[model samples]
Structures are given as C-alpha cells and as structure tokens.
Target: MLKKIGFVGLGTVGKHMAENLAKSDYALTVWDEDAEAAAALGKLGVKVGSSAKETAKGQDLVIVIVPESEQIVFGAEGVLEGIDPGTIFVDMGTHCPETIERMSKEAVKRRAMFLEAPVWGSKEHAANGLLTILAGGDEALLGRCREPFSYFGLNIIHIGKVGDATRMKMIVNMLQAELLVSLSEGLVMGNKMGFTPDKILEVLDSGGVASPLFHSKGRSIARGDFSRNLALKYVHSQLERVLEAAQKFGLELPAAETARKLYAQADADGRGEEDFSAIIKLLRR
Candidate 1:
C-alpha cells in the first residue's frame, strides 16, 4: 500500500520506467541531475524535486535506477540522506554486489528497507512495460512493492536477499556478452566465406540457436544499423564486473575475457554509445 513514490535517475530506460510509474495511481516525486530530463517527467504530472534528498524526504517508497552505485549511495545529496525511517528504497540497476550490500547496511542503520532489483531488457522493453525484474531483498518488502512494479515489469522474480540480484545480473550479462560475441564471430565468418549478411541471419534465425535478441539485433547488425538499445559501454562495464566476480572465486572465464577485449575495442573506436550489436563492426574491421 506504499503509494507515495520518489524516483531518482532518468536515463534511457529509467525515464520510461518512471513514466510507467507516473501513469499509476501512486503519487510520484522525481529528481535527476539533468534538468531537461526532470522537466520532461514533470510534464507527465510527476512532481519534480530539486535534489535526491528532497525527492526521498517523506516518501513511502524510493526507487533508484542509476548507472553507478556511488551516485545513489554516496554522491552529494544522495538518497540515503533524506529517506525517512521505515521507507522502502529499491535499486533497480546493474551494479557491484558489494556496493549494494554496503548500501543495504546503511539503509538498515537508517531504519529503512532496501532491496536490490536489477532489471533485464532494452530501452524498447522498458518503454513498453515489458522489462523483467530480478528482485533481491526481504520477500515481505518485495510483496509490498509488487503492485507498483507491475506497472513496468513483465516478470518480477525474487532472486534472494540483498546483493543476490546484482550477482544474478552479472551472471546474466556475462552470458549475454558471450552470446553477442559468438553471434558477431559467426556473422563475420559467414560473410568472409561468401554468404550474404541476410543469408547468414536467415540461417541463424531458422535454426535452434535463434533467440529474440538474435532476431532483432541480428537484423540490425546485418543492415548496419547500430543505433543504441543496450549501449556497448554498459555491456563492457558489466563484463568487467563479471570478470572481477569470477576472479574472487578463483574462476577463469576465457570466453568472457576475450569478449571483453572486443567490447573494449568497440568502445575505443567511438562506438561505446552505440548498440552492443556494434561489436560486429569490430569483427568486420
């Protein structure tokens, strides 16, 4: 029944998620560093707050979906500063588990509830309210927030307790990175072997290895359209986090390490802001 919502972060996907929330019956107050972004949300009948602390103050629920963990937990005028005791704070961003654990401890100290609920999907999915949400925290707390989540999430899965969502996101992203790389390699090799890009896509799509990602992104890659869906830079960051987590457990991921290098090359080539499918461009070069 927590209807008062304070949302921070208004980036590509976050903005759409916030918009879906604004459409709900819940009263929403939002803040972002980008004034233009905040203004856009304000036009949707969402009350715009001047800062993160101001946004969190007196709200029954605070949701953050930023790129970096520091911005939410330790940045100037962060959410931690103004959230009232007993308010629930949910982070639906992909970040380091350790950072989220630290934030969870700080939330407990403030007598506030915290949940890590990283999501999976592109900006298109977010815009259409089809994103899959992986939540990690007290199940009771998640139950309290389920209705609001239904506005934007097609699936709300309880992964475990705090930090588990982040770990799950890393695992998912690692596989995503590898899959994209494998697709890129296959396309490039087929092209070199005299098969047209369209032919390659047709073969892949008609086969068992086909997926929604391959269907959408493969067509785009074949057509040389690298417009941003999930940016290469963010994928590269996730790969780094995955490798870091693997190392902590004395594990080796040779495929992920190789794919990370390709993504790094794409970023260096000024394709960081482009779709992750642009890694195919690196292979072509």
Candidate 2:
C-alpha cells in the first residue's frame, strides 16, 4: 500500500506537495534544511524529522524533491543514511539524466527501488493539487504509489525508466525557457511599438500560437509581478542540463543556448529567486 511516507526537501513546489500529502491518509514524515518549512507541515499532522536520514528511517516510501540530487544522497546526513532495504525512493525534481542515473545506482546499492518522477507545473498548480507527474521507473511501483500520487498530481504519466523522466523534464523546461524568452521579447517589442501589454496578449490569445502559458505568464509580466513561482535559477540550471545532454548527443540547440545565456545574465544580476517571466527585465535592458 506504500502507506508510510517520508518526504525530504520543502522548496517552492515541494512544500505544497508535502502539504497535500500531509492532508491525506498516508502516514507522512517530512524534513528540510529549513526548520521553519518543516514546522509548517507539522501543523497539518506531518511528523517533522530532524534530518533527511531521520525522515527516511523506517518509512515505506521516501520522496526527495530537492534542487540537487547529490546532497540528498551521498551528502552529509543525507537520506541514504536512513533508507532501509525495500523502501521505494522517488525523486521529483528537475536534474541532469547523469545525476538521475547515479542516484538510481545508489538506490540499487542500498537494495531499495528507485523512481524518478520530476514534477512539471507551477506553484499555483502544486498548490491546487494539479501538478503533472512525469514518472520514470517500474510500472508496478508506479501503480503501487498511484493512490498517494493522486493526492497531489493531476496527471501521472510513466515516461519510461530511470533517467528517462529527467530527459523529458529537460526538454519540457528547455522549451519553457525558450517560450518565456520569446514571449518576453514579443511583449517588449510590441510595447515598444506602442501596443499595450494587455493588447498584445489579447491579440496573441486570438491567434494559433496562444497557450495556457502565454495567458498566465503574459498577464503576470504585464502586471509586473515577478514573484517566484518557479525560480529562474532552477530553469537556468535545467537549461544547462539540456545543453550538457545535447553536447553529449552532438545536437546543437541554438535557441536553448541563447535562452540559457539570458537566464544566466538574469541570475547574475540577482534575479535568480524571481519567477522565470521576470527575465523580461533582462530583455528590457
């Protein structure tokens, strides 16, 4: 039944996912480097573990959704320390395929089952329990976890196995980075040509290129609200992963490379914590 669950990492979307889990019937335990983040979950009856290891200890399932893979595994006081054999581990973060493969190997070494289900959605979707889960691992394991997963995921898709979900997530976010940059340039260009941002959005919405992303982020940028939904730095990191993978496959992604540089420049200017739509500020400059 995968009844008992331990969750590590309480960043942006992770916090919301854990919150949904705590609200569910599963016995949930959570931990994070930030005491305050873990404390919030405690209010909802989630047991706050002292560390990642402490959380994973004795739990049937352990989910790690941190920004980096290594820190939660082989890092100091990491989750691997607490993981018992037969525990099913799921990582729902965007990371390089190489890193995901390494984590899978480490999980196998510990005699635990592994799944990489990097989540795809904004903070709003996570908050509303509508995040899409791109899962990659054993099909039987996914079926075992479906009940708990349904508590937070709107769509639970099995992409393939091991590093597969990570690869998909890279492409998803690479296109996201490109799309946002393109939208930003359009808004900036249209605004400079004396069209209101709203008008530009209205026109785009009336056309074939219109999408949900365009509507939501376009309005947010129009309102000048760059509040962090998905951190720009993370998107930038995903682009790096995409480029790294591309380099290995000998694929030249000109658009992704150019978009990564824009995100990099924005990150350097101290806008890393802002929403990805906030890259328009860099484009505006």
Q: What is the C-alpha lDDT of each candidate?
A: 0.90, 0.90
Tell me each candidate's RMSD, in Å, in order: 1.3, 1.1
Q: For candidate 2, lDDT tens digit of each residue in 127-213? A: 899999999999999998888888889999999978888888888999999999999999999988999999999999999999999
| Pairs of colliding residues, candidate 1 | none
Tens-place lDDT digits, model 1, residues 148-184: 9988999999999888889889989999989999888
Q: Give the Å shift of residue 262 in candidate 1.
A: 0.9
Candidate 2 wrongly placed segments (more than 4 Å)? none
Could you say which candidate leads in TM-score? 2
Clashes of 1: 0
Q: Candidate 1: list runs displaced more than 4 Å.
A: 69-71
Q: lDDT score, residue 31, model 1?
A: 88
Q: Give the TM-score of candidate 2.
A: 0.97
